[model samples]
Each structure stands twice: as structure tokens, then as C-alpha cells.
Target chain A: MRKKGSYRIKDIAIMSGVSTGTVDRIIHNRGKVSEEARIKVEEVLKKVDYRPNIVASALASKKTYKFVMLIPAFSKGDYWEIVNQGIERAEEELSGYHIEIERVFFDQYDKDSFDKQMEILEGMEFHGIVIATLFKDSVLRFTTRLDKMQIPYVLIDAFIENTHCLAYYGTNSFNSGYIAAKLMYQQIGPDDKLAVFRFIRKGDSCSTQVLKREEGFRTYLDENHFRGTIYPVHIHADDNEGNRNILDSFFLLHGDVKAGIIFNSRVHVLGDYFKARKKKDFKLIGYDILDENVAYLNNGLVTHLIAQRPEVQGVNCVRDLFRHLILKEKVKKMNFMPIDILIKENISYYNNYI
Target chain B: MRKKGSYRIKDIAIMSGVSTGTVDRIIHNRGKVSEEARIKVEEVLKKVDYRPNIVASALASKKTYKFVMLIPAFSKGDYWEIVNQGIERAEEELSGYHIEIERVFFDQYDKDSFDKQMEILEGMEFHGIVIATLFKDSVLRFTTRLDKMQIPYVLIDAFIENTHCLAYYGTNSFNSGYIAAKLMYQQIGPDDKLAVFRFIRKGDSCSTQVLKREEGFRTYLDENHFRGTIYPVHIHADDNEGNRNILDSFFLLHGDVKAGIIFNSRVHVLGDYFKARKKKDFKLIGYDILDENVAYLNNGLVTHLIAQRPEVQGVNCVRDLFRHLILKEKVKKMNFMPIDILIKENISYYNNYI
Candidate 1:
């Protein structure tokens, strides 16, 4: 017998009359060993001085991996820049491994734009794909193609439950909205009416976040036994004319609506519209950052901004992809980055995330 | 010629008259080739097209790594439990790469305990070590020995400025304390007297964190134009009787003392002493999560707890160690996790990290 804490797997292997692979398999409890062989191996292992040399083993066997990521480009108010920042952080930290990333960015708004991007991607081979698709039709079509090809992929920022995906990373849009509703409920009394404004681009189908957020907002009110009326309105995201008309119609209809919730990034437009009209104060909650949103956030027009660390989602997705592709590691199927509640006090610290 | 977007690196390599390794090196800019060779390879790569096959590459190279972790054990009432939780999380996520972690825990308060642990560790070979040391002299000695032996190491939750550590993961102690003092200065007036309380175990080394925090707290007071007597006190962490006498004497001597700050985790004892005597409120700031401190926080006796995600530190340290051992990656010499300000409203969220 060796001295205290001085034993190796080679000794165990020699004693057991087994190969090192067989010994390792037994140690890690990998399946497919004969009962007789396993018993013999275990009997010898109990007597011998044996421990795995982890560092040398890792160095000798370290393999390289590669992953491919395809997502919407951060253009025209796309919040992908923050997500890219998150990806970069993960990349810089994980650069030592053989894991590499290939990225393709598609336009956010147009369906044909996705098709054009897909045309460029069909021939490129990859272990996995990470995508944030705004339109259901395009997402389904692309996902189906991947499924048929048997390529593993993760969805970031948004997820489609119907598709076969390896994993997802994003905030639960509905839960965030529900939480926001609860926050408003605490400050506003039973007599107040709440309105939800959704600014969606015309024909933009990746409104899953908006729809889920709206559901969560209403669910909070319903669950809390609140007797407040909730009004939801959808306006063209970038159309000032449509936004103005919807705002006018909603205010004219309610006249007493005290608090408002804007689902998605167009909270800025609502803030701008209100600021232009010079309304002093109306408790408002919104999603994402635009120049308009920050202005409202600072001026106290936007009471809370439900920030989903977009950059973190981006960074984490890439990190997970690296793990899956390079390490042949099992990545978590559903990775939910926290729903950060941002007020003016905490907003400055979080300004650089995305 | 193949259809658009239908070609891969294999086709490019075949046309380029170069090995796939050469092609990969060119793509990554690893730069070992002559200019003429590089130009020729690029010319052929452009002609034939080169898309990466991410999956085949991952599957082909099935590498596993071994990491060795040497950390401080959770002594009775020690907050290192939170740090262990972080390490476990990183391990769970890293299991896919066949990355196995062998952990050895040493007592923080005893030098002989660490020596005994290190003696056992030297016989058992490892690629890297991640440690949180409280006994600075022994630790620095061990670190130097490890460096001489050519083993990589990462330090967390402390600052040993002169050492050549592979990485340091924790708070920017001085800045964190300075920020805390600035926050306190906002509430306390210029005429008010402030007291600084440092709770330390008898015979413990005066750590960089403690010194830096004290320096920062004092600097803030000086810079803010506060004209008041600032008294500093260091008391035995476990000596309740001695601590009480010092506390009572300080209060009696300076009855006009308006605020106090605890540099370490000794606020619990102070909070308890005050509670026993029925003093409910004090503008107090302390560090870490001891049950006594939490009670004071809930009751509003302690104004704030400067939380430095201990769990995150543990997790990141192990992760860094893994990268060094398994992936052959170089880690940063210093990694400062953000200093989080914990208040009553956000204390519940701390459970996630723990």
C-alpha cells in the first residue's frame, strides 16, 4: 500500500486486470459493464490506492468545439446591441477552449429580410443555431428546416414552444408584465383605471413578448382581486400618426385613466407623445430603452422600466452554445435571465447593459 | 460549381491545396503561414467557399478536463456556505465537458489546518487551485510554493496585491467602501459625529479588504466637507462581553454620535447588544449576511448591507479554475464582482445567488 493520499488509477487498473477506460467507466458509473467484470473491478478498487489525475487527463483529452448563431440585427432601435455585448463577455471569458462562434444577423422587421438571410444560411453547416425570430411563419419555417436537418439550436429573447429547440434564454414576458401590474396596484388605489398600450409595427409577427406581457399584466389584476378596468391598444410602432390617434381615442374614451402600461420597446413613443402634449404626471411602466424611454424614465413619466438584460441573454446564449458545441455538454433547455425592476435610482447603474 | 451557399470548408480546403488545419488557422488569424501561402489559401478559399461544420467538429474532438479546487471550509458561523453554493452551480453547468472537480477544503482560522490540507494536496497532483485565504502568511507561502512548482491558481474574496496570482475574484474593496460612505454622507449632516466599528476575531491578520474599506469610509467623510468627530473602533468578533463594554463606553463618551459603520461581519453582535438594551434605530452600515445582521436589517436598525455576491465569487473562481485546467485558458489576474447594495426591498432576491 502507498502512503496516505498517494494512489493512482493505473494501480487500480493493474490490480483489477481491466483497461483504464473500463476503470473510468466504472468510476463515473457509465452503463454497459458485465455484472461479473463490474464486481471484480469494484472489489479491486476497494483495496487499491487509486485517484484520477484530473489536470493531466484534461490536458491530454481536451477537444475543440464550434457553434453558429443567427439572430436579428440591431438596426433601427433593435435592442440586440446589448445582447451582443453579453455574447462578447462570454466569448472573451471562454476563449481558451476550442469553442468558436459564427454569427449571422438578420433584419428585425421584414419577413422577406429573414428569407434573404435564410438563403445565405442554408448552405452553411453548424452544430447549433441561436435565433430570435419576430415572425411566427418565418420562425416555424426556419425551425422546421433545422429540425429536418437535425441541427440543435437555441432560441434567444423569444421562444416558440411548438418547435424542436435545444434551449431558450430570455425573460418570461408575461411574468414581468404581471409583476409590473402588481407594483402599480400597490401605489394606486381601487378607484384607479389602468391602460395598456402596445406599439407594434405593421405586419410584425414577433409580438410574442408584447402579447405575453399584456397577458401577464391582466393576469396580475385578475389574480389580485382588483376591480380596475384594463384597456389594451395596439398602434403602429413607428407611426406617429397612428400613435397620436390611438392615444387621443383612448384618453377620450376613459378620460379618467390614471395609470398606463406600454408592452415592448415602443414605451418610448408613448412617453414622447405624452411629453409633447405636456402632461405633467401619469404613472407609466414600459419595456426596453430608446432615447424616448430614458427621457421618460428620468422625467418620472415612466415609473418603471421592466429591463430584461438583453445583453446577458445574448452573452449567455453564446456561452451555452459554446458548451453544447465544443464540450459536447448538455446545456439547460430553458435559461431565464432575471427580470430586473428598474427605477430611476437603479437605472444609471444599468444604463450600459445593452 | 456548387449552388450558392451550398459549399463548406472541406470543399475550400480541397480547392486551396492546403490542409484543413492551415485553413482553420487562416480563418482564426493564428498566423503561422508565409504571406505567399496565406494569399494562395485565401484565393482558393474565396473561390470554393468555406462554411464551418460546427457539429462534426465538436463530436470529433471529445475532450474532457480535470480541475482541482482548494478552498476554505465553512467554519461554524462562517458565511463561506454561500460561496460553496456558487462553486456547486458552476460544477453542475460544467459537467458536460467531462470536467471533474476534486475539492479540498481547509479551515480559514487555523494555519496548521491549512498546512495539513496542503500536505495532503501536494502528494495528489492537480492542474490548478482556487483558494479563499484568511490566514495571509501561510496562504502567501503556499501560493509562492505553488508558483515555484508551476501550478496555476486563482484567488477570490481577498486582495493580495503583490502576489502573481492567476486571477482574483471579489470586490474592489476600497471603492465599494467609499461608495457606501458616500451613500451614508447623503443622510448624515455635517455637525453629526460618526463611528466606525470593525469586528474582527482576535489574532486575525489585518486584511486588505478591511483596511481599504476603512480608508474609503474615511476618505468619503473628508471629501464631503463633514466637520465632525469620526471615531474608529476594533473589537473582538466573538467576545460579546468585551464588545458590549467598548460599545457602551463609546456611546457614553460620545452621546452625540449620529451614525456608525461596521467594516466586516460584526454588525450582528453590535445589533444584538443594542437590541438587548432596547436601542432600536441607528444609521448603521455593515457587510455580509449574518443572522443577527439580517434581523437588524428587517427591524431597520441597520440601514444597509454592502453585499458582494459571495456565491458568485465561489462559482466564478471554480469556473476560472476549470478553464485553466481543462481548456488550457489563461485567466484574468483580478476579477471583481460588483458591489451590491442590499436594502429591505431587495433582500429577498439575495436567496437566488445563495
Candidate 2:
């Protein structure tokens, strides 16, 4: 009889009086085995109560795994560049384990570019995929295809619910907004008017992530019975003139608006505008610690900047995929990164991770 | 002739017309080798420009490493308990790689207990050590003997300067204090009176960590030209009546003290004191997110709690030692953990790491 917890396939085979291949076939339910051999193997399995060590099994298999990453092109800015750096670090660390990562980038602002990349990915064979789901419709369409092909994929940066994604590593946009509102509420009076800035590409809808944040911000204000009027204005991300025009009009209409909150990392634009105009009275809260935003914070133009650790998100995406695909480990569906609050004092330490 | 990067000791042995062991002996200067073989091996090394991969070398050596952890007993409180949990996680993860970790805990409040533990450790043979240096004099003595034995060690929770430690994974107490002061300064006016509380056992001197924090806090106030009167108080951690009496005397001497800063996790004592007196006007800031402190923060009694990420520190201490001893990697001397500012809103997310 096989010893409990010490029964390898060979041991099972010996106990069953069958070939090792027959034991393997019986265990994995793959290939054909004689009924008598199968019955004996089953009996041995029940007697031993053998549990496989998936990690050891994976290491011993000696099979190479290919992971494909579909992310926004690094040409966008330091944001994507930082994420790419994290992915590269994970790739290098896992290289000795016979895993290869292939990166495919698409223009973040263009649907057609994303579609083109998705088409390329459809023809490629990979064990798993890691994607930055910026374009919702495109990602949903591609994820459907990925599901049909039985290819597991993890999402980063933006999370969409009711999707077939194996897991997601990103921020909870609504909660981040709620946190921003809480910080803002602490510094502002009940009667003070507030301005909200949302940056989007021309003719493009504001991303679901941004919209959720705005909604959460509004929810907090409404729930707390905040008496201040909230004036929200959207400006094109690349259009300097449009940004200036929107801000100027909003300030002119509500001159008493003492504090402003930006929904995204485009807070630098507002910081620069405030500095040029010499508006020292306005308190600003923004998201992310991009260089420009931090500079603005240092200069006292931006009062508080909420940080989402993009690098940690990137690293976890690769690690989660590796665990699921190679080690047969079950992965959590959602991994929400901590919302880091960075003022001028603690930003230096936060910068060390990237 | 060996290639530039692929020169192994086997190749060196072949070139020197000796056994690989002889080549290894020549390379490491560990064992006696014939003069001719040493000279030939040196010549082959110079010719090939061989650079050894320490990780691969350690793996191939098949050495089992035993690491000893010296820290305060977990029975002290949640702080040490959290740290022990982190160490356990690392031990479990590293067990597969033939690494064994033995924990030795001492009484945090008693120097003699620490010394006794050190005496036991001196009689043991361990490859590496991870220590929480609670008692400075005792730790210095043990570390001196450890250096003589050539056993590498990492420090956690508290860092001592100019020590023969492989690395330190902990908070920079002074900087955390400075950050705490900065946050306090923003909320209180320059004319306001501020109270500083340091809790300890009766007749116990405040730890170097706590004193450093107090120094940093004073530095910020002096540098910023804060016009506030600073009230410093110390209370016995377990003596509730003594804590109340001390606080009452401080407040009666300077009733204008509108804000208070506690230098350690025992801020909960002050929180309980404030709640019992129904003092709503005082703004309180403290260090750590122990259960009582978080409850106070949630109830709006504690305004801010600076988190040193003890669990992360624990995990990193073990990981750094593993890299230094087993992988032969050069670890940086000081690893200052991020000072996490926890308000009630973000505490849920921060709680997920442990």
C-alpha cells in the first residue's frame, strides 16, 4: 500500500501493479488505461489520500510559458513608461524560470490603433495576456474573443465589471474620488464654492474611470450635505487654449471658488495656469505624482495629490498571471491598490519605488 | 580556451590540468592548492574574464541555510504580533528553497532578558540573523561577537549607526516625526500651544527611536519659527490613573494647548483619556494603527496616525538576509520604509496588507 502523502505516480503505479503511464493516465484522466489498471489506481489514490504539490509539478514539467502584454505605448508619457519598467523588472526576474513576455503597445488615444493591435494578438499564440484596458469598447470586444479562445487575461489601470478577465490589478476609481472629496472637505468651508476639472481628448468621451471618480466625488458632497456649489468643466488634454478658456470662464463665473479638484493626472495643466495667473488663493487637490504635479505641489499650487502606485500594479499583474498560468495557483479576481496620499513632505519616499 | 562569459570552474580545471575542486580552491583562496595549479587557474581566469553568478553558484552548492530571528516576544502586543506574522510568511515562502528560520524572542522591556537570549544565540551556529534591536547596549554586545564569527545580520524596527549590519529594514524615526510635525503645523496656528506625549514604563528611559522622533518634531517647529509653547509630558503606559493625573497637570499648567502629538503607539492611552473627559477641542496626532488607535481615529478623536508598515519591514528583513547570505547579493545598508499617513478613510485599504 502507498504511504499516506508519500505516494507519487510511480508509487501508485507500483501499488496498482500497473505501468507508470497507466497511473498518470488514471490520475489526470488523460489517455486510455485498462479498466482493471484504472480501478487499481483509483483504489490506491483513495487509500493514500495523495495531494499533488502544484508548484513542484509545474517546476518539474520544464515547459516554457509565453505571456503577452498589451499596454498603451510608452510614447504617451512617463506614466506608461513607469508601468513598462515594472513589467520589465518582473520579466527579467522570471526569465530564469523559462517564461517569456512579449509586449505589444497601442496608441492610448486611438481606437483604430487599439483595434489593430488586438487583431495582431488574435493571431498570436500565448499562454496568457496582460492588458491595460483603457478603451472600454475595444477591450470588451477583445476580451470576448480571448474568452472564446480560452486564453486567460488580467486587466490593469482600468477595471470593468462583468467581464471574463481572470483578474484585475488597479485602483478603485470611485473610492479615490471619495477620498479626494474627504481631503478637500477638511480644508474648505461649507459655503465656499468648488471647481472640478476633467481632462479628455477632443471628441472623445471621458473615460469610465474618470467619470466614476467624478460620480464618487459628487456622492460624498451630496451625502455630507455640503452646501458649496460644485462647478465641473472638461477641457481637451492636449489643447492648452481650451484648458485656459475653460478655467478662465469658470473662475469668472464663480470668482468665490477657493478650491479645485482635478479628476486625473492632468493637474499639472491647472497648476501651470494658476501659477501664470498668480492665483495664490486657490487650493488644489489632484491625482498621481507625475514630475510636473509634484513640482506644482512643491511650489504650493497643489495642496494634496492622491497617488495610485502604477508600478506596484504593473508588478502584481505579471505575478498574478505567473501564479495562475504556471503554478496552478488560484488568483484573486480584484486587487485594488492602496490610495496613497502624497503631500510635499512624503512624496520623496513615494518616488523611491518607481 | 574558455569563452568570455561561460568560464566555469570545470573549464578552469581543464585549462589548469587539475580537478575542479582545486580550481575552486584557487578562485576562493579557501583550500590549499599546488602553486602550479593556482598559477594556471589564475592565468585561465585572466584570459576568459569570467564573472561568477553568485545566485547560480549558491544554488549549485546545495547548502542549507539556517537563519535566526531575534526580536521581542509576540506576547508584548499587536505590534510584535504583526511583525511575527510577516516573518512567518517569509519562512513559509522560503522553506521550499531549503532555508530554515528559527525565532528567538526576548522581553522587550527587560535588558537582562535580551542579554540572556543573546547568550543562547552565541552558542548556536546560524548562517544569518535578523534582529529587532530593542536594547541598544545588549544588541551592541551581541553584534560585536556576531561580527567576530563573521555571521551577517539584518536589523529591523530600530537602526543603529555605524554597526556591522548587512542591512536595516525599518522606519526612519526622525523623518516620521518630522512628517508628523509638518501635518500638525498645517492644522494649528503658530500661536497655538502644542503638547507632546511620550509613554513608557515607570522609571524606563524613552527609547532612542522615540527620542529621535521628539527631536525631529522640535526641529520642524524651530525651523518653521512656530510661536507655540511646547508642553512635553511622559506617563506610565499601564497606569491609567497616572496618565490622567499627568495630562490634567499639563493642561492645567497650559490650558491653551489645542493640539497634541504622541511619539509612539501608546497614543491610545491619550485617546482614551481624551474621550473619557469629553474633550472635543483638542486635535490629536499619534504613531501606528494599533486596534485601539484605529478605533479612536474612526471616532474622530485621533486626527492622524503615522504607519511604519511593520509587516513589510518584517518581510523585507528576512528577504534581505536571504539575498545577502544565500544569493551573495550586496544589500543596501539602510532601507527606510514609507511613512504612511492613515486617516479613517484610507485605513481599510492599508489593513489589507497584513
Candidate 3:
């Protein structure tokens, strides 16, 4: 038995017959020590058992870094709000280190908005940037500028593979798509017809997440050997008229479709479409937990939601940025967020931040 | 916008009329250029946009580190097993860095066993340590020695104050207790007398999670403004004879007590007690998802079992260790695992790894 807090580095040094400076240098990894001395020092220190006081270390350290987040603004009932909450929580926790978070939100629905935001960002100086890869052209241009400026940045929610970015942290789109497909595959028998509804905007910027998800969903069905007629329909997500026209034409053409899967955030329209038509038995699965989607889930219209921890993804983007710039640390090239399967029974327990 | 991946540091240097060596030195912080040169270089670099390739950086960097885990050994169930799973996952993810994990598991039922483990650990070398602080005396000695040695460690599952640790990641015990109390509180009305059982082991190491849970459960009653008499009983968790004797006498003495709560993992014995008597409808709440407890929960004997993400905690412990050791990253000192409320209807959905 030993008294609490009785151990000290000086004691280890004294017992080992080593200079305190040598011990300090070894602890801090300050170089220039003989191999024999280094081994002897480490051995004696291990024998005594040493642990650093982290609180004192934190307080004594004067390192501070700024992490900036540039992403889509949180609209009413949008998923980005959840992501903002996660970012706020991370910011509060990291406040101890004097790490500052500067958030800049742009409209995902508009390309000019991204360019406008980029123009503003070009004039400012930041240590690191965490941006959602929403508008590819603007992102590439901004990230290219960031690269030239030697400012480290991480991509969140979506990634652009060809460009040089510090790191990427978001959902593994393919795995999540596969998980969703598995769920649907289990739910429906081999004889049932399946439809994948992708709400694509006409002349809109491409979203890599949607493409990856569609590819993954298709791959699952192919791999699982499902013997059913599969149909895919692409409609403008933001245009209700476009969605209705395409859906109407498709349903009229193929009235035998028993189940539908929406590959992206516009699943709410499917819910609205199905609910209005009173098509109760058509099994449906989609992405996210929008209020409209939750309403559909509660009403038993939506069978499942393949949720990406968008909030944690947002916060981690900032955290990773700080790690790269402030700590001068090596950032991971790709970080896949967990794919949370949210059902009506379990949605209430889902972490509010996510 | 700009051609994809066409930009590089050489282009920026060419555009700026500065030597590539000067630009590379500036980016890597070699510190030879004048202030005017640095500002001029930064301006041109920003105009053309140069991004460092992370793939190149990851390939070029050479670093290796050691992470050690000190936790309780897997006992009758998967309490520590889930955590080990998390650790192994992190190890796999970090395998490319030449990083290593050295795990030393100690007996939870014996303080002397833990002390011996600590003694053995004191003789070893590690860059970081992740400990499940189950015993006070052993942990205090271990942590103090670690502090003296200037080795940073993180606390998981259980935490102690007035000591140095890099970070703590576990569930909020008091809040969990409050949740337990809430669960049991809902089952019984104010007229009923409640009992809290602490399945103790005379001289063995017990967790503060138990005590905090008890406190939180009690506080729930106080906060909810309920009127109920609460009785706490402590008995050896494994002593069936002693437990039966104590319960028989206690029931005989306090016949009015209709509901009970186990602030620890001894819910199985209570289930066994009830099964022996063939008792029905006495409100019960316990902890974890052990096989015995799961049987009880499924049999309608246990009303609510509060579950922390045991597997996630285990996985995060390793990830945290790696982040601290390899990346030189600072981890959160106290990461409160999500306080998940598990019900029969939602348990399956909540079981996925985070």
C-alpha cells in the first residue's frame, strides 16, 4: 500500500541516479541522449511507475487553434440542424483549449450561394476548414485555394475523391446503402416488386452521396440474388410538380410495385405522395429523420430510416481540423461514421445530437 | 471551375516567381524566408490555390507508438467482452501505423489481484494507458505512479477524482441511477415502499458506478417530488445462502416493501429469488445485458434494464488511446457514453455498434 499522490518524477530520477534534466528531456522527447542512457532511463522510470498530471499539463500548455466550419445552412426541419447541435457540443467541450470554431453556412440548393460564400472565405484567414462537399465546382476551387494557401481542411457529409483534402469524415455511403438494402430485402419476399425513387434535381449539382447510395442499393440486390422486377425513377427533388409528374407516370406504367426505397433526403415527398393516395400497404424505406419523415414513420407509412450520424459528422469535421492544424497531427484520410438504423420503435431513443 | 487535381505546390511557386524550395520550406515551417517573402508567397499561393496531398503525407510520414490497456478480465459474461471488441476494432484500424496495443486484464473480485497487476504494469513501458478503474487502492497507486512517470492514461467505465488522467469516457453513473430510479419509479405509486439492493462482496473492489447509481436513483425520488420509503440492502453478490437469509429476514421485518432496485449487476440473483418463490408483479430494475438478466427481462420479470453502449465504450477506449498516442491528439477527459434506455420493443434496434 502506498499513500496517494506520493510518486514524483524526481523520485524516479533520484532512485535511477539520473539528472532531472535528462528525465525531463526523455519525457518531452527532446532529442540527444545516448542509447544506453535512454534505455536505462526508460527502465528505471518504468520500475518506479510514472504518470503525468493531465490537468496541470492542459493548464500549463498555451496551445490554441481555430477550426472553421463551412457547410449548408440549417433550414427548418432539415437534418443539418441536428449536425449543428453536434458541432455546438464539440465546441463547448473544446473551449478549454481556447479552440475557436467559426461557422459559415451556405445554401445547398443554390450554386451562386456557394460562390458568394467562397468569395467571402477567400478574404479571410483560418487555420483549418471543415466543409460539406455540396457544390463540387466551388468546393474544388475553394479547396484548391486552401491547398495553395497551405491551410488544412477536412470534408464532411460527402467527399470529393480526386481533390487533395486533409481528411474525410462521414458515413460510409456504400455500407449504409447496403444495410438499408438488406433491411428491405429481409422485409420483402423474393416475389415482391421493388422500386428505388431518387429525387434528382434537373440541371442541379451532382451529390456524390446519392450516386454512391444508389450504386450500393443496386449492388445489394444484385449480390443477394433477389428475383424481382426492380425499377428506378429520378425526379427533381425540390420541384413538387416534377416529382408528381414522374411518380404519376411511373405508377401508372407499373402499378404492381409493392415497395419503394428513396435514396436521399427527399423521402418526405414519397411519404406525402403515398399518404395522400392512401396507399397503406406499400412498404417504404428512406433516409434521415425529417419532421415530415418522422410523421410518416409514426403513421406507419415509413418502415425504416437509414440514418447517418450527421451531427457527429459535423462536430468531428471540426475536431479533425483542429487536430491537423493545432496539434500538427496526421489526419486520417477517410473516417466513416456509423450507419444507425432508425425504426419507429427506436427513433425516440436516438441521440438528439444525431 | 478549375481542372480537377491539376494544381500543385510547384504551380504556386511558379506563379509566385518563388523557388519551390522556399514554398516547401514555408509550408513545412522550416523558417528561413524573410517576413516580406513569407507574405508575398502566401498571397500568390492563395490566388492559384495549392493543396497538399494527404495521401502523399500519409505515405511519407513514419511514426510508431504503444498503447496499453489495463482493465478487468472478462468474467461470467460479456461486460468487458464488448469493450474488448471495440478495442480490437480500433487496433485493426490503426494497424498500418505500426502501433501496438498491450492489454493487461486484472481480476475484478480481488483488490490484491489488481494491485499485483499494477505492480507488474509499473515494470513495463507504454506511451499511453487506458484503465477501467474498478478498485480504489490499486488504481490510486497505479495512477499516481503513472503520473510520476509522466505517462498519460484515460479512465473508462469508472472514474475517480483528485487525480490525473488524460480523459474519462463512461456513462454518467448518477444519471444512470436516476434513470434506474425513473424506471422503477414509474412502476410503483407513492404509497409503495421501495428497496435498493447492493450485491456486495465483503472485501472485494466495488465500483463507484454502483454508489453513484444509488445516489442518482435516490435523487430521482427527491427531484420527482415522490413520497416513498426507500430501503438499501448490501449483501455478497454471489452468496446465495447469505442473500436468501438476508432477504428472508428483511422481508419478514419489512413486509410492506413491494418494489426493489439493484444498483449493480446482481439482478440475476433477484430474478432467481423471484423465480424460486414464483412471485409476480414486484417492480424490478437492474443493469447490463447479461444472459441471465436477458432471460429475466424477456420473461417479464425485469421491467427495465439500463444499458450503456458497452461495446462502443470498449471500442472507443482503444480509439482514444490511439488518438492520444499515435496522432498526439488530446482526447476528451470525460466522455459520457449515451445513457440508452432499453425496452423490449426497442432493444433489438439499439443493439447495433456505434
Cα lDDT tens digits, model 1, A23-118, are 778887896777877888889766654445543343245564556677767754557776776777776766544455777877665667777787
lDDT of 2 by residue, B143-206 (tens): 8988999999898877887679999887878888898998888789888888888766432545
* Residue range A180-206, candidate 3, lDDT tens digits: 787687678777798988655533676
> Per-residue lDDT for A339 in model 2?
82
Model 1: which docking level applies? incorrect
Worst 10 residues of 3 chain A by lDDT: A1-10
How much lDDT does each candidate structure score? 0.71, 0.80, 0.74
Q: Write the per-residue lDDT of candidate 2 for residues A297-322, one digit (tens) a residue.
A: 98889989988777777777888889
In terms of DockQ, which candidate is strongest? 2
Q: Over all chains combined, what TM-score does candidate 1 have?
A: 0.54
Question: Across residues B1-354, which tens digit of lDDT does each residue of candidate 1 receive?
Answer: 553334555566677777777877887689597777688878976765654544334324556455667776665555677777778888776643445577788755455776788788778777777767666676788888888988888887777766778888877777777867866775677878888886554345565577788888788778878788888876775688998898888888887887888877667777887788787656888888766677788788887787666777777787777666655567666666656566553454343312
Ten-residue segment with the worst summed lDDT in candidate 2 chain A? A1-10
lDDT of 3 by residue, B1-354 (tens): 233233566766776678888888887889699787688789976765655655345424665567888887886575787678778877766554556688898866667777888888877878888888777666777888889999988888766887788888777788778767766765677767988887665455567778788888888889877787988877675689888888888888987888898976668899898788777777788888777877788787887777766777777777776666655567777777656555443344344324
* Higher-TM-score candidate of 2 and 3: 2
Assess the local accuracy of residue A21 in candidate 2 as a C-alpha lDDT between 0 and 100.
89
